[model samples]
Target: MRKLALSDEILLKVEKPARYIGNEVNSVMKDKEKVDIRFAMCFPDVYEIGMSHLGIQILYDMFNRREDVWCERVYSPWTDLDKIMREEKIPLFALESQDPIKEFDFLGITLQYEMCYTNILQILDLSQIPLFAKDRSEEDPIVIGGGPCAVNPEPIADFFDLFYVGEGETQYDALLEAYKENRRCGGSRKDFLQMAAKIEGIYVPQFYDAVYNEDGTLKSFVPNDPHAKEKIRRQVVVDMDKVSYPTKPVVPFIKVTQDRVVLEVMRGCIRGCRFCQAGMIYRPTREKNLETLKKYASEMLKSTGHEEISLSSLSSSDFSELKGIVTYLIDEFKGKGINISLPSLRIDAFSLDVMSKVQDIRKSSLTFAPEAGSQRMRNVINKGLTEEMILEGAGKAFEGGWNKVKLYFMLGLPTETEEDMKEIPRLADKVARRYYEIPKDKRNGKCQITFSTSFFIPKPFTPFQWAKMYTMDEYIHRAHVVNQEMKEQLNRKSLKYNWHEADVTVLEGVFARGDRRTSKVLLEAYRLGCLFDSWSEQFDNKKWMQAFENTGTDIAFYTMRERGKKELFPWDFIDAGVTKSFLYREWERAMRGEVTPNCREKCSACGAMCYEGGVCFEGKN
Candidate 1:
């Protein structure tokens, strides 16, 4: 029997002791002496949130399948456990083996969002590992980071020895095999990193140097080591059907954020929304085989016994075989009291009909993400949604017994005017008006139209990457404009408006487009106690401000500055399938308020054709 990392006394004190305990259902176990590599896969957040991530689940299942590799999971302890561990001087440990993380061979952290930056330091600090990669010894785990944030690894490059620069299913086997070979040859730590750098999609930050011009724009990023390539092309999986899927995912004792079985129907998006980073990075959308998905749905549900199943994708409706798979799922499990969820679907007759079958009409609300309020602003962002479409969708839902409607929009978009801001509430009012158009005898109760707006932040691999951001005051003013306009509507009682905190959005913007120079500010902020910035209760904007002031880092430089046409970005060295020229051309189109067609409608020559698969070669021989 394995021993517990925390004592009974300590476990009794924490909120969710099950989070620290190992041996959950479906968690793999192996003898330490039998496995050649003990990998510690981490999601740098609390257990509940980390357990909900699909990427971690997929990678965990993939890693544990190898006989020589025993992968264990670790999540950042909550604040209560964090304080106790610090006071007791206990090192962070993995859940499966109940062993200290410092004893592992690799510490793979997924960078899912910008707000989780400080939590990465928290994980390192508690594990007694060196916070910076340069200070680590051979005994310490080779700290690596991946996921969507890996596209812009420069902001946190100093802290990670290496970064796996794309889809984990592609090159992880090569990386692990190289590590095994290096160990068998008795190579030094740096020698192993040099070997790892030779593999595609692997980035060794220490081997590369970034030079900045006097104006702080990136001058050049060249690699010093011969093994390190000049450009690290993102690894992509051309054949989605061939990759392993996590059918038997581990079941947590506590309720997680996504407490259901998730079936990823596709890998990429056909809709080319200009402000979307995922759509740009994951090009040439690929859908899973319908037969394969039907098989996995049964297997996952059988394994985890989850009542609800959600179809995961950038755009679930865009899946070519969505109707077929959904029909199969409903037919296969309808009588067994199973629930099906479909998100990211466009609001239309077919979608409404499908959702009506799966979801309870009276209890559920319909959601529409117009992204921008006005048609002109929608064109600028390439939302491809019009006010007429939104109202028509809402009208259908209202007639179909969905009285509650949720609308999402973005504030501070590039070239957003006062008319655009006011259009947000006006659009909501229009939806409410459509709801009241129904006769009182046939309609549900009073209609509730809720609309939320989040400030736009320019992300790394999007057409908006070169766009400028507004100050905190400017953002709040825009939200207030929308709020004030809501009161003037005829059905103001049915309309509700809310906006996100400007401070956090501003900080996220800085981190989203930040360079290596922002690392000092991050270090200082973590030292001053800034963990879980995404959580409302724990976020301290005052501490962040002090960190910036102490580090002499100006936030405006990252957020408010306009980029020249030829200015090089920090992520220029990464070739993420989508050409920079294509992105720039899209940016030009966005500035002209010209709408570019999605992948299915017409090929825009975005340079993802090099893969020669997926949507790019959908119909061709």
Candidate 2:
């Protein structure tokens, strides 16, 4: 496939022109003639957002670092661009070289969010690749996936030939290097996948066969190769500071989420929230040094002309040297127009102070994630947060002259009761009091509070893996309960209660924890115009319901039926680091309202670091 050189007029006629053009400072440009394998790192989204993602940059750096491999970027063009590409008969092309994606040896997509599922399919079709793995011939580009979503790669399992279960920092290069050798031997894609599967952390879904029971529940998944490791240990890179990272983030032609240099201060979470797939999948937390971070940020800003920099991680507050990093960013970027944003902030006084220090007092809104309303429920989920601590943080926020607070919670957790449901407003009222207590001069005086709750979704590798989630009716009723309770106490005008319609999150939980049986419903949903179901505008509950009804599978089978500890999860054949016993023990502790200290504080012995020859804690095995 020849590269279609889009005229300046045509490139502008599509959408964000950044999607096509390349050659930013520090962007990889290897000799296509010398490279043995060319990879198109396709993000199933647009350019601005894709350029902002740090993982894409890291993998881009990792692959292109190998002289034998040249990795380029591919993104889903916007609706207007897609139409134009189809009309112009133009194939999807990579950013750096303006080469057609069809010419690449490998095509990898970051399956970051479930919402991007259809977009992934669209990219494949646009790239002129087969949508289903089975339909593709051996000569087709080897399609693979990575990210937290890949842990339960069931819904899209039929699409990707390989799924990288955990960290890709080190394993990505090893897999490519191995593939390069095999390519020289003229090996088939299957042989390449088989060999790649042998690399730690890569799961070749094709090597395993899934079986289901009569009720459409996942019965078991059997690996065709007995010698194949059932559990894929998550790939961990020791000394995260030394890993290949994008020193100069891609400068976007338009605004994006971060649109700036992103430096990963850390990887993994120490606060083990059971509902979080990333927390479990990214075990044994690791961090980058403050000096290296400063250098990266300095270099990136100077090279890319970025205005804002972000410290990327699952939870930024968990960084032991967070105080120093925050202090450094504040001191450095204060005079310049540069701003630093931290995602995944844990709720606490110290973390709040960090937020307050870096952000302008008036412009910043307090964001808190209780996850659950009541303490008992929080304990059951091992949130490691107390009502008192959250209220204390709220008081500090109010004292800081903030007028609004956005609180996040989850409904439909196991063992949830009406009492727990009422706590949502009870907690909100406490925060409201703190707001009113502010002195008249500080008060511009009107205070607003928003309590938003999302329906809980059980995921793979968490303690709740075997737990049954709430039904739709129960979820809706509970959401209403919190809303009514809050409405009655606070002025309806002063408080805003927002809850997600159970339709999407419930289905998210259903498919996320579901097995190969879900493939039928997924296909039916797609056939029934459920494509782009992630979009609020396009998601149709009626179509999804019909699809499920056609498959003779009720929502309860996926969302409400609790499996026993002994039963095999449909994804059992696919391992996401951290042992089952560790999750079970954590589950037991949660049931008794027990608290497991953070990994940095003490090693919980989840068996996450046994293979690493040392414990991941500060200093223990």
Candidate 3:
């Protein structure tokens, strides 16, 4: 039996002791002596939140399938346990074997959100490994990072030995093979990294150098090593049918954020929203075969015994065979106590019809992400949603018996005006009015319409990458403009309004567009007791501000200024299959308040056609 990493006395004192214990169902265990490679996969968040992530699960299953490899899972210890472990001087351990992560061959951390940057440092500190990649020797595990944030890895470049540039499925086999081969030949850690740098989709940050101008802009970025490519090409899996999917995922001991079976209906999005990084980075939308989804859905449900199943994708509605899969799920699991969850759907009659069958109307609420209040603002962001369409969709949903509705919007978008800010509540009021238009006897009750606004942060590889961000006070003022307008509406009592914290948004904006110079500030912030910054109750804005002051870093230099078209960006060396010229053209169109058509409507020749698959070659011979 594997011994618990923590003592019984310590486990009883902390909240959620199960988080630290191993031996969950379906978790892989192997003899350390027999396996040639030991991999520790981590999501730098709490166990519940990390377990809910599908990306890590897929990679875990894929890696463990190899006879010579043994993969395990790790998560950032909750604050209660974190203090205990530090006091006890216990090194962080992976869940499956309860062995110290320092014993592993590789430590792969997923970078899903910018707020979790401090937690990355926490992981390294607890594992008793060197925080900086340069301080490590061959005895330490090779710390690597990947996922959406890897598209802009410069901000945390010094902490990681290497970064996987794109989708994991396509290039991981070669990377693992190279690692084994290098070890067999008795190569040093640096020698192995040099060999790995030559593989596609792998980035060795130590081998690269960044130059800055006097104006605090990127002067140039170049590779110092001959093996490193001038531009790291993002790997894309054209044949989704051949990719691995985890049917038997590990079941958590406690309920999680997403305690359900998940089936990915597709990859990428056809919608070209200018401010969305996922839409741009995951281009040339590719989808799985309907039969493949059906098989995975049934297998995953049976293996986990989950009552709910969610269709995962950037935009579920854009899946060409959506109706076929939804119909199949409803018909097959209708009375079997299985619930189907379909998110990211564009509200339409077809969607309403399908949702009405699967969801309980009284318990569920309809959601619409118009992203902007005014149609003009929507066009500016290329949201492609109209007022008439929103009202019509709300009316249909109300008639279908869903009285609770949620409206999502973003503040601080380019070209936003006072009128645009005020229009957000007015739009929600219009939807509320549409609901009340139905007869009182036919309605469920007083309709509750909730509208939420989050401050927008520009991300890399998107059209808004060069846009200027507002200060915390400015973002709050924009939210206040919308709140004051809500008071004047006729349906004021029926509507509720909420906005996200501006402090986190400000920090996230700085990190998103930040360069290599920002690493020192990040290091200082982590040292100043800034872990779990993403949690509202634990976040300390003063500590972060002091860290910036301590490191001589100017927040305005990263967030408050706009970039010139000719200015070089820190992420310029990444070839995400979308050309810089194309992004600039879209930025120009956004400034003109002209809406660009989605990928299905027309091809703008954005350079995603280089993939030569998916929607890019849909009509070509």
Number of the top-ranking candidate, with lDDT as the measure: 3
At residue 439, give the lDDT of candidate 2. 81
Candidate 1, RMSD to the unseen true structure? 1.6
TM-scores of the models, in the order given:
0.98, 0.92, 0.98
1-621 per-residue lDDT for model 2 (tens digits): 434457777876765676667766677777799988999998787676677777888888777768888898888777777778878888888877887777788999997877677678778877888878878887678899987788778778888888887767777778877887887898887778778878888887778887767766667776787535677766667677767777755676667777677878887787788888888777767778889888888888898887777788888877777888888888887689888777678757787677776677677677889988888998888888898888878877777667888888988887888999989888887788777777878774678888899988888889888788877888889988997788777555667888997878778887787666667777777667565566687578899889899988777877778877777776676556677888888777776777777766666777665213223443223
Output the worst ten-in-a-row residue range by lDDT, candidate 1: 612-621
Two-way TM-score contest, 2 vs 3, winner: 3
Q: Report every candidate's CA lDDT.
A: 0.91, 0.78, 0.92
Badly placed stretches (over 4 Å) of model 2 are 1-26, 83-89, 215-217, 347-349, 549-553, 610-621
Clashing pairs in 3: none
Per-candidate total of colliding backbone pairs: 0, 0, 0
- In angstroms, the error of model 1 at 541 is 0.5
lDDT of 1 by residue, 196-265 (tens): 9999999999999889999788899999999999999898888889999999999999999999999999
lDDT of 3 at 277: 97
Q: Give a tens-digit lDDT track for model 3, residues 1-621.
A: 889888899899988989989788888889989999999999999999999999999999999999899999999999988998898899999999999999999999999999999999999999999999999999999999999999999999999999998999999989999999999999999998999899988999999999888988888899999999998988888778998999999999998999999999888888899999999998878889999999999999888889999999999998899999999999899789999999999999999999999999989999999999999999999998899999999999999989999999999999899999999999999999999999888898889999999999999999999899999999999999999999999999999999999999999999998888899988999999999999999999999999999999999999989889999999989988788999999999999999888878777778874323244452211
Worst 10 residues of 3 by lDDT: 612-621
